[model samples]
Target: MSINPTESCLDCGTPLELTIAGQKKKPCPKCGAYRRKREYQ
Candidate 1:
Protein backbone atom coordinates (compact mmCIF):
# COMPACT_ATOMS: atom_id res chain seq x y z
CA MET A 1 0.00 0.00 0.00
CA SER A 2 1.06 3.57 -0.68
CA ILE A 3 0.68 6.40 1.83
CA ASN A 4 0.20 10.01 0.76
CA PRO A 5 2.50 12.31 2.70
CA THR A 6 0.21 15.28 2.06
CA GLU A 7 -2.45 13.53 4.11
CA SER A 8 -0.26 13.45 7.19
CA CYS A 9 -0.42 15.93 10.05
CA LEU A 10 2.17 18.66 10.21
CA ASP A 11 2.49 19.06 13.97
CA CYS A 12 2.75 15.55 15.38
CA GLY A 13 3.23 13.77 12.07
CA THR A 14 0.04 11.78 12.53
CA PRO A 15 -2.03 10.37 9.69
CA LEU A 16 -4.77 12.76 8.50
CA GLU A 17 -6.20 10.64 5.75
CA LEU A 18 -9.78 11.47 6.71
CA THR A 19 -11.55 14.63 5.69
CA ILE A 20 -13.06 17.14 8.12
CA ALA A 21 -16.49 16.10 9.33
CA GLY A 22 -19.19 18.10 7.57
CA GLN A 23 -16.86 21.09 7.17
CA LYS A 24 -16.65 21.40 10.96
CA LYS A 25 -12.86 21.72 10.57
CA LYS A 26 -11.80 19.61 13.49
CA PRO A 27 -8.21 19.21 14.63
CA CYS A 28 -5.96 16.24 14.10
CA PRO A 29 -7.24 13.15 15.92
CA LYS A 30 -3.85 12.00 17.20
CA CYS A 31 -2.09 15.27 18.04
CA GLY A 32 -5.03 17.67 18.04
CA ALA A 33 -3.21 19.89 15.59
CA TYR A 34 -5.32 22.40 13.71
CA ARG A 35 -5.15 22.80 9.93
CA ARG A 36 -3.49 25.86 8.47
CA LYS A 37 -4.13 27.54 5.13
CA ARG A 38 -1.45 27.63 2.49
CA GLU A 39 -0.87 29.81 -0.58
CA TYR A 40 0.22 28.47 -3.95
CA GLN A 41 0.84 29.96 -7.35
Candidate 2:
Protein backbone atom coordinates (compact mmCIF):
# COMPACT_ATOMS: atom_id res chain seq x y z
CA MET A 1 0.00 0.00 0.00
CA SER A 2 1.08 3.58 -0.57
CA ILE A 3 0.98 6.30 2.02
CA ASN A 4 -0.10 9.71 0.88
CA PRO A 5 0.98 12.72 2.91
CA THR A 6 -0.34 16.19 3.52
CA GLU A 7 1.94 19.09 2.67
CA SER A 8 1.63 22.83 2.98
CA CYS A 9 3.00 25.62 0.82
CA LEU A 10 5.95 27.54 2.29
CA ASP A 11 4.79 30.85 0.88
CA CYS A 12 1.01 30.67 1.26
CA GLY A 13 0.58 27.89 3.82
CA THR A 14 -1.96 26.15 1.61
CA PRO A 15 -2.81 22.58 2.42
CA LEU A 16 -1.77 20.16 -0.26
CA GLU A 17 -3.06 16.62 -0.39
CA LEU A 18 -0.31 14.76 -2.15
CA THR A 19 -0.09 11.23 -3.41
CA ILE A 20 3.01 9.19 -2.81
CA ALA A 21 3.31 8.34 -6.48
CA GLY A 22 2.71 11.93 -7.54
CA GLN A 23 5.20 14.70 -8.18
CA LYS A 24 7.56 15.78 -5.42
CA LYS A 25 6.25 19.31 -5.58
CA LYS A 26 3.44 21.27 -7.17
CA PRO A 27 2.19 24.81 -7.70
CA CYS A 28 0.17 26.46 -4.99
CA PRO A 29 -3.52 26.77 -5.85
CA LYS A 30 -3.91 30.15 -4.19
CA CYS A 31 -0.84 31.94 -5.50
CA GLY A 32 -0.23 29.95 -8.69
CA ALA A 33 3.43 29.80 -7.76
CA TYR A 34 5.59 26.74 -7.43
CA ARG A 35 6.08 25.51 -3.90
CA ARG A 36 8.34 22.89 -2.39
CA LYS A 37 7.01 20.03 -0.38
CA ARG A 38 7.64 19.80 3.34
CA GLU A 39 9.81 16.84 4.16
CA TYR A 40 8.61 14.44 6.80
CA GLN A 41 11.64 13.01 8.46
Candidate 3:
Protein backbone atom coordinates (compact mmCIF):
# COMPACT_ATOMS: atom_id res chain seq x y z
CA MET A 1 0.00 0.00 0.00
CA SER A 2 1.09 3.56 -0.54
CA ILE A 3 1.06 6.05 2.27
CA ASN A 4 0.02 9.61 1.77
CA PRO A 5 2.85 11.64 0.27
CA THR A 6 2.18 14.32 2.84
CA GLU A 7 0.95 14.34 6.43
CA SER A 8 -0.01 16.85 9.04
CA CYS A 9 1.28 17.19 12.58
CA LEU A 10 -0.97 15.90 15.32
CA ASP A 11 -0.12 18.78 17.61
CA CYS A 12 -0.10 21.83 15.41
CA GLY A 13 -1.76 20.36 12.36
CA THR A 14 1.10 21.47 10.18
CA PRO A 15 1.43 19.69 6.87
CA LEU A 16 4.72 18.01 6.10
CA GLU A 17 5.92 16.10 3.10
CA LEU A 18 6.93 12.49 3.58
CA THR A 19 10.48 12.14 2.37
CA ILE A 20 11.09 8.69 3.87
CA ALA A 21 9.09 5.55 4.35
CA GLY A 22 7.90 4.20 7.71
CA GLN A 23 8.37 7.56 9.32
CA LYS A 24 6.06 7.84 12.33
CA LYS A 25 7.20 11.19 13.55
CA LYS A 26 8.76 14.36 12.22
CA PRO A 27 10.01 17.66 13.58
CA CYS A 28 7.57 20.46 12.82
CA PRO A 29 9.22 23.26 10.90
CA LYS A 30 6.93 25.81 12.48
CA CYS A 31 6.78 24.58 16.07
CA GLY A 32 10.27 23.03 16.13
CA ALA A 33 8.91 19.99 17.94
CA TYR A 34 8.32 16.40 17.02
CA ARG A 35 4.84 15.53 15.79
CA ARG A 36 3.18 12.25 15.02
CA LYS A 37 0.83 11.38 12.18
CA ARG A 38 -2.84 12.05 12.78
CA GLU A 39 -5.37 9.28 12.54
CA TYR A 40 -7.28 9.17 9.28
CA GLN A 41 -10.63 9.16 11.04
- Best by the TM-score measure: 3
TM-scores of the candidates are 0.44, 0.50, 0.51
Number of colliding residue pairs in model 1: 0
lDDT tens readout by residue for model 3, 1-41: 65544567767888877546675655888886675574442
Question: What is the Cα root-mean-square deviation between model 3 and the actual structure?
Answer: 3.9
Candidate 1 per-residue lDDT, tens place, 1-41, comes to 65533455668766565555487666888878886433222
Query: lDDT tens string, model 2, 1-41?
Result: 66545677778888776645655555788987676466563
Tell me how many clashing residue pairs each candidate has.
Answer: 0, 0, 0
As for model 2, its CA RMSD to the true structure in angstroms is 4.0
What ranges in model 2 sit over 4 Å off? 1-4, 19-25, 39-41
Q: How many collisions between residues are there in candidate 2?
A: 0
Which ten-residue region of model 1 has the weakest summed lDDT?
A: 32-41
Best by lDDT: 2
